[model samples]
Target: MKVIHVGVGGFGKQWVRVLRSSRKVRVVALVDVSEPALAAAREAGGYNGRVPCFTSLQEALRAVPADALVCSTPPDFHREQVVAALRAGLHAVSEKPMANTLADCKAMLRAARETGNTYVVSQNYRYRPEMWTIAELVRKGGIGAIGQVRIDFHKGVAFGGFRAEMEYPLLIDMSIHHFDLIRFVTGLDPVSVQGTAWNPAWSHYKGDCSSSVVFELSNGCRVVYDASWCAQGDYCDWNGNWQIEGTKGTILYRNGEIRLLKVGPRYKVESSETMAPKPPPADSQHFVLADFMRAVKNGRRPKTDVYDNIKSVAMVFAAVKAVKTGRKVAVLDKDSR
Candidate 1:
């Protein structure tokens, strides 16, 4: 397959590296608005003078023979880029959160629908071995009827670029991963959300760096998610700490280990055991790219296809509304809104 990859700085550089290593696909064109980023990506590997380079997506679409497009641009530009790619008769994969707003997400989905092009969002966390285990357990009733889920995420770092200035940095940029993960694991759609966003006085970010959210899922499960991007000490892993409570038992996942505890009759303490995670199928990015390619070839929707992922984007928007209004906001589906 021939590909056109956009954005070549920061996370974009990583995407370029993945494209360079893929045996089934070749990057035919590189696009970036920043010349410095383009030159730096060219210097990094595989995409030297042989491949065409453009500063604009429109020019690349007109000039390149691209089978698909992999976009790593900012969330705000995702709608324009992905819509253009779909209209150009190219399948597209975009980094999450799918878009900055629900309206933009809807527009992107509409383009894919009208063009009959495959559009996928990179919800990479769903591909992890641990997540796979959790999903399987929940699906097979290993944890019984799930009543509640708790996720606590914390990381202390400084990436002083677009993130520092973005509003609700923690909620918009990071919580989507966990939100998507929850949806994937429980196979439940979110019904409503109540949230609060805050930034500490000592924090460096201009926007809110911390948030607490309550998500009501379709299965009558309540998920409490708390996160902070500017936390100072004792941080959790990138995937965070998670606990799932069911009628019969509870599943605990912290750091890299998974544990299951069964409840005895009459609510007594039963047995607890550590569950082993399955070997990962492949690297997360590779899994996503391979899935996209397979979906395109088979004329099927990818697992993280935008048609379904738009709901995850809706969850983000609903949370934002909750934070602003200090009230629970309904998660509106496509037909309703």
Candidate 2:
């Protein structure tokens, strides 16, 4: 597969690296609005040998023929770039938070549907082995029907860029991963969201850097999430700390360790099992790239296809609505794929 990658900024560089390492796809063109970023990505992507770089996806597409377009641009730019790519009859893979708005997500979905091209959102957390194990355990009834889930995340990093200027930095940019993870692990679709987003006094970002959200899932599970990007003290891993409660037991995951606690006949902690961390089968992007290739080849929807991923993106938008309106908002129902 030949690919034209858009956006060569911070996160964009990661996409470039993944494309260079991919055995099934070749990045034939690089596109970015910034010339310096384009040059850096060209060197960092290790495609310095006469590969074309352009400042715009349109120009790049006009100059080259490619099987797919990888969109690593910001959320606001995703709709235009991805819709254009799909309309051009190329399969597209976009970074998380498919687009800034639900309307844009739906539009992208419609474009991909009309074009009969694969549109995948890279929710890489789903490809982790631990996440798969959690999903499998819940599916197999190891913990019975999940009733509640709690996730707490804290990280202190001074991000000095456009992210600092975006609205709801924590909820839109970071919390989407956890929201998607909740749905992925519990096999539940979000029904409603209630949340508030705020920024600490010491924070540098203009957008909210902290958030608390309560989500009601389709399966009667309640997920409570609290996160901060400006925390100063002890912090959880990038994946966050998770506590899942089910009818029969509970599952705890923190610092890359998994532990299960089951109730005893006497109402005590009967069994406790700790699982050693298992490496993923491949890099997250590799998994996403491979699935995209397979779906294109088999003419089937990929695991994180836009139709399915829109739910996760909706969760973010719904949460933002809740924060703004000071009331709960319903998540959009998934349309027929």
Q: What TM-score goes with each of the models?
A: 0.96, 0.95
Candidate 2 structure quality by residue, lDDT tens digits, 128-231: 87776777777888788899999999999798776799898888888888888988899888899898888989999899889999999988789999999999
Residues 1-337 of candidate 1 have per-residue lDDT tens digits of: 9999998787988888888888999888989999999998888855679887899999999998888999999888899999999999999999998888778888898898899999999988888888888888888898788899999998997968778999887788888888889888888889999989999888999998899999999888999999999998889898899999888888899988999889866866588889898745776778899999999998887899987887787888889889989999998765423
Clashing pairs in 1: none
lDDT of each: 0.88, 0.87
Clashes of each: 0, 0
For model 1, what is the error of residue 278's alpha carbon versus the real structure, in angstroms, after optimal superposition?
1.1
Instruction: Pick the lDDT winner.
Output: 1
Error of 1 at 150 (Å): 0.7
